[model samples]
Target: MPGKDAHNDTPRRVLDANFPDLALPAAVAARLPALVHCRRLASGRSLFVPGHRPTAFYAVAAGEIEARFTGLDGTVSVIEHVGAPRLFGLAAFAAGQPTEYEAVARGASEVLVIGREAYVLLMDEMPGFARALLAEFARRHDGTLRLLQAARHQSAAERFVLALAQLARERGRAAGDGWLEVTATQAELARLAHLSRQTANELLASAEAAGRVRRGRGHWLWRGDRE
Candidate 1:
């Protein structure tokens, strides 16, 4: 109940304007307004959890969603942050399997929920559009796999720095003077980097001393590598 919201008539144009990553073709985009339901979530509430069968995949219209995996040993791995306009839960839908991760709202958020039936209908009616969506899914899956591999191979400090850099690339705003501002708290960063909070803080302090970044109250100003 904490995360639930009543559906509203959100326009397709609004969805496109808010989430550019969706990038549905014109025809498919035009039809989505009628086929989807909208939901709003409060911070830290779950959208779905492991073993639950979801009939819909979600696109974050606003805010962030964290997909986390918990092992039997109780170690929780933050798999990804699904920021605005990004899609999640597609692999489960494709495989017709129960969800394997817990999807939780990172803060106040809005999501566009496309049901399996509507998704299947669209795919059947628009092969090209389906191909585009599939391609996007493949690309993201590859990226996630790479990140997981990096976590396995990298040291904690290395993982923290690399995770911060990647977060900056994806979500940070240009703060001028070669710095990017990312709105992530220490706990969140630690989770993302797969480190304990104290370990993450120590690494951040060292980085700050080296002039690599300036940690702010609730955000970070990082001097990222030039790309």
Candidate 2:
């Protein structure tokens, strides 16, 4: 569950920090203050569930959100983690369809919610904003394609390593003594890598033996050495 937070003024620095890749035009940026709302979500709380119609575009202001897909048998797989200063829910919102994945808070998080009407208005009125958003969509599409290719062609160990590398790049923080810590459980990492828990455990054991990664109680530590 998300609690409403009254946020009438959204600062430009905040937007700039959140969307470093997207350069919004002054016109679009100026209008965002009035068009956005803020919400706070506690850990393990859902921002939105599958099959829910999207009323707004969501961007992470702080903390992380996990995108998960639940099957008919009620099994859940984590699709990806969207950390602070990133956007999510763009696909469904842009297509005007119900979301297929559930967006859940990975920790206490702050999110910027832009209503669908405001988003459409910005797109219709600002060329620069529209182009920037479309480019972001293209970039994400390319990343997805690359992941799919790796899944189809790479060896299981190779895929696991790649997945860990990607997570380290996205979610890792310096933990001292040349180690980078990633905030994810082994089971979550397995799902993100599209591997079974047993296989991921085996691969991780091999890596640990090689002095590459160390598994913490609820996280992972990597030295960033890929060789």
Q: Highest TM-score among the candidates is held by which one? A: 1
Q: What is the C-alpha lDDT profile of model 2 across 26-144, one tens digit per residue?
A: 77666767778778999999999988988888888889998887889987766678887777898998888999889999889988897876687667775566777888788776766
TM-score per candidate, in order?
Answer: 0.79, 0.75
What are the runs in model 2 whose C-alpha is more than 4 Å off? Answer: 1-14, 21-28, 120-127, 145-155, 173-181, 214-225
Please list all clashing residue pairs in model 1, or write none if there are none. none
**Which digits, one per residue and each the tens of the lDDT, describe model 1 over residues 61-91?**
8798989998999998988787876678889
Error of 1 at 196 (Å): 1.8
* Model 1 accuracy (lDDT, Cα): 0.78
lDDT of 2 at 162: 69
Q: Score candidate 2 by lDDT.
A: 0.78
